[model samples]
Structure formats: C-alpha cells, structure tokens
Target: MNKFILIAAVFLLTGCPGPMDPVPQEYPAQARLVDNKVCITVPARAGDKIFSVQFGTESGREIYKTFGQPDQQLPVVQGQCLPTFDFQFKPGERYAAYYKLTNPHTGPGKLFAARFSLEKSENGHLQLKQYSRSEY
Candidate 1:
C-alpha cells in the first residue's frame, strides 16, 4: 500500500499536460436552409466526438443547447454527420450556430468554429444560412 501511494504521489507531483487552445464558450458554425431545416455538416475524424451545440440569435440568445453532447462511436466512420436544426427564419436576415468537437478518449481535442447567413426567398420563405470558420 505504501509503495502504491508513493508512486501515485510522484505522478501527481509531476506536471499534468492539458489540451491547448480549447474551444471557447461559443463556436463559429453555419447552417443552410434546406427543405424547411437548417443543416450544418462538419466532417468528423476517427474517434472524434461532439461536445456541445447551440443555435443563438444574432443578439446572443440561445434557442437550442444540447446538454448530452453527441459522439461518433464507430471508429471507422469516415464522414461527417449532418446535424440539422429546424428553425424559422426571415429572408435577408442572418443567424449563427455553434458546435464543439473533442476526442472522448483523451478529453483533449480541437475546436472548429463557423458561421452562415439566411437568405429570404421571393415568397418570404427563409432559406440558406452561410458562414466561415473563425475565432468564435
């Protein structure tokens, strides 16, 4: 027991390495209006996981915040999942969505931020949200 304790203490005394440049409270994501649903598809790496996602108003109001972050369980899954958020928007107006990605195994991962705009059709139907990945 004493030897085990000693080894544990030594490990703790050493510095711990943490993930660098983690995603902030918010991210930069975009969505496009398609068939009455807003969709944003980001390619996933092997073993990658989705930590959190949200749809916020241009004024900073969060309409959708998923607590149980989604994860990609299959290691061989090579493509991205199209996470769609159904929304009602006005044409000629814009909105933003945010998403976070991580490595569930390591708890350390990279973040991708993106944005998009909504285009109003002639019939007043809102469609197409577009944006670029940048600092959230």
Candidate 2:
C-alpha cells in the first residue's frame, strides 16, 4: 500500500496536461504574403554565431533579410524568429519567397515554396484577408 500511496502523491503533485496543450511539429520552410510584407516562418536555430536569413523572389531576386541571435540560438518562442519585409509588387502578381539561414559554423538551410503569390481579397465591406498564416 505504500507504493500505491507514493504513486498517487506524485501524480497529484505533477498534475496532468489539458486537452489544449499543443504538440510541436516540424517542416522544411515556407513563406506567405501578409498585409504589406511577406513573412517567412522557419523553425530552426542558428547553427553558429550570427544567423543570417536571406530572402528573394521567384526569379531569384532579392527581397528582404534577417539576422538571428548569436551562437546556438535559444528555443524559438511562438511566432518568433520569423523574417518579414516589404517589397513592391502588383496585385495578383506571383512571387516566390525563398530564404537561406546561414551561420558561421553551418551553411544555408534549404528553402521551399517557390510559387507563392501576393493576392488581395475582400470578404465584406470591412473584412479583408491579408495574411495567409493563421494560429489556432
């Protein structure tokens, strides 16, 4: 009975996870146009000191840049470590958002999503969808 009581005490102190606790997932990389800027969300840390994020267009044209923390990067917070910037593009104009994360010790990370487009749509008199990424 002592073992059972000890187990019960441990379980009671630790508590249990709620239904809403989300588990983390991983992906390669991607980008989307939101509002006035194209944001790229990459779940990675700087392999070394000075992580550099280079962005470009579908035709391999330069778009934006971002520099991450030095050394081994800290655990990324929700919605953190994202590179966002503005580029002049016409409506309905297709764009390719590519990024390369670079550090001193490691080479650039691979990029995907080369067929993204900047689009604007009106849902109602005041309801307009700008950004594509939505957090639940």
Top model number, lDDT: 1
Residue 49 error for model 1, in Å? Answer: 2.3
Q: Where is model 2 more than 4 Å wrong at Cα?
A: 1-27, 33-37, 46-81, 105-114, 124-136
Point out the worst 10-residue segment of candidate 2 by lDDT.
127-136
**Model 1 agreement with the true structure over 33-122: per-residue lDDT tens digits:** 457556565555667655655566565545554445344322223333345345454445556655566666666654544565667678
Clash number by candidate, in order: 10, 1
lDDT of 2 by residue, 28-93 (tens): 444544455555556555452223344444455675554454544323333443533445544455
lDDT value, residue 133 of candidate 2: 23
Backbone clash tally (model 1): 10
Q: C-alpha displacement of 17 in model 1, angstroms?
A: 19
Against the true structure, candidate 2 has what lDDT?
0.46
Stretches of candidate 1 exceeding 4 Å from the true structure = 1-30, 64-81, 84-92, 105-107, 123-125, 133-136
For this target, which candidate reaches the highest TM-score against the unseen true structure? 1
lDDT score, residue 16, model 2? 57
